[model samples]
Target: MAAYGYFLSCEEFSPSQLLEQARMAEQAGFEALAISDHFHPWNDEQGQSAFVWSMIGALSQVTSLPVTTLVTCPTVRLHPAINAQAAATSAVLTDGRFRFGIGTGEALNEHILGDAWPEASQRMDMLEEAVQVIRELLTGEQVTHHGPHYTVQNARIYTLPEQPVPIYVSGFGPQAAALAGRIGDGFVTMTPDADLIGRFRSAGGGGKPVIGGLKVCWDTDRDRAVKTVHRLWPNEQLPGELAQVLPTPRHFEQAAELVTEEMVRKATTCGDDPDEHITAVRAYTDAGFDEVYVNQIGADQRQFFDFYRTRVLPDLPRSR
Candidate 1:
């Protein structure tokens, strides 16, 4: 069945705040939870980036809902071997409820290492290699790998769960989606793009689940919510390859200046009415997503949960 989930922007809330939100989300009937894994908030104004791993540990204890990273980059800030170990432990802690969702990454987060950011093609290569390394390590066998981007010697995860954690890969374009289909157990993308989903399945994803998410805001004042989203997440509206190539948050902020609040409002659903949120989610459902997750942007956490549970969830058609 298609699953309904919520995406938590970890950088936007304190750990305690997130713990509360998770509990509320569970009680409100969300089937799963996906959290953003970023070393830094896209901009400092967004305010928080509590280490995601630590937050995940706390989340496992606070709620019964399954938690996964919306997408984490295993090739850069953290090595695949270490990531594998972390995922294994998290899976055990969550009682096999963890899914490792990963992607090629953004310059805003990965470029902090002072390493020259490779081109997309190279990054994909690194991702493929990283996935192999991670999978091998999860086997609970000694692994020694010498790859173009990574090397691990005699590594074996001692804290692995009874089952290997499923890896869901996020992609935007056709090539990346195809890569996810070929290598990932499931496919993840933010866009509600049916063509991309078809390409992924055609490229060998088979019957694996497809997950997509969109941002929304639940507020009595729609205009204010749109303005707030654009002010804080203007980077969402920047088009083209610039997002991939921008080297710094300042660059992002500069480019983001060109995106108007209207653009954000047009792209996202923001309003007091839960129907608006349901319509936004329906776009993803109609686009052929196996699962659609909604992310409530800005604060107003309690109101957002209540809006979804009382007004939106009841109206959504059950996934077939």
Candidate 2:
């Protein structure tokens, strides 16, 4: 059976709301959580971007469900060594129920430091080196290295869990997936693309956990739910690599203007039909994702959880 998780949208909720949601999620029977990490929301309409590390620290205190950064970018903004320290401390705080999920990152968050965004290829290279640095530091051993994309000098993570934290790498394409296979303890992506998961396994990631997530609005008024997601998450419909390269929330707003209501309807599952929610989430399990996270796109989180606990989770099958 695939474990179902609640996805905390840091871009759309305040820290307090997130904590409460975490408690409600566990009460609803979700076994884990995946939270977005961003310096800014996709647009001004979404209106919140609490620091993920701080939210995680708060989550550790009140929730028992395991938490993971849906995908933090350790390649830029924060050095990998610093991220390793934060992650180690988070695992300690969470009683070793934390998993580290990381990606190359977006220009919107990383560019705030005045660094030029590297091409996707170079970012992949940087992610590899950064993961290596983090793995070394998580061992609680001092590490020194100078690689193509990063450098470390006797950096070590002092606050560590009993076991080294599992690092999951995120990738949307084959090249990155293969890298995730070779270096990551696990793999993460957003879609139900079995081929990508197969590629990861063929390249050496067999038997490791695969985490995937999708967005859904669980309101009874279907049209209003669509409007809510359209207003707050038009960025979801952007094609190609726009979500990764857009430099600011305003740029995202401008680009997202081109996203139509119809596209949002086609991309997200909106409404209260438990059957539709079951079908929507089942795709991830069918695609071989070991865990699936559902992000409630609007503020009606408690309603969504109540619905899932009663109507949705029963219909979904678990693979683990």
TM-score winner: 2
> For residues 33-88, could you state the per-residue lDDT of candidate 1 as single tens digits?
99988877777667788887898899999999999888889998889998999899
Off by over 4 Å in 2: none
Question: What TM-score, over all chains together, does every model reach?
Answer: 0.97, 0.98
- Locate the minimum summed-lDDT window of 10 residues in model 1: 38-47
Stretches of model 1 off by over 4 angstroms after superposition: none
Candidate 2 is scored at a TM of 0.98
Model 1 Cα shift for residue 3 (angstroms): 1.4
Superposition error at 240 for model 1 (Å): 1.9
RMSD list, candidates in order: 1.2, 1.0
Q: For model 2, how does the per-residue alpha-carbon lDDT over 1-320 read when each residue is reduced to its tens digit?
A: 79999999999999999999999999998889999999999899999999999999999988999999999999999999999999999999999999999999999999998999999999998998998898889889889989887889877777789999999999999998999999998999999999999999898899999998999998999999999999999998888899889999999999988988889888899999999999999999899999999999988988999999999987777544
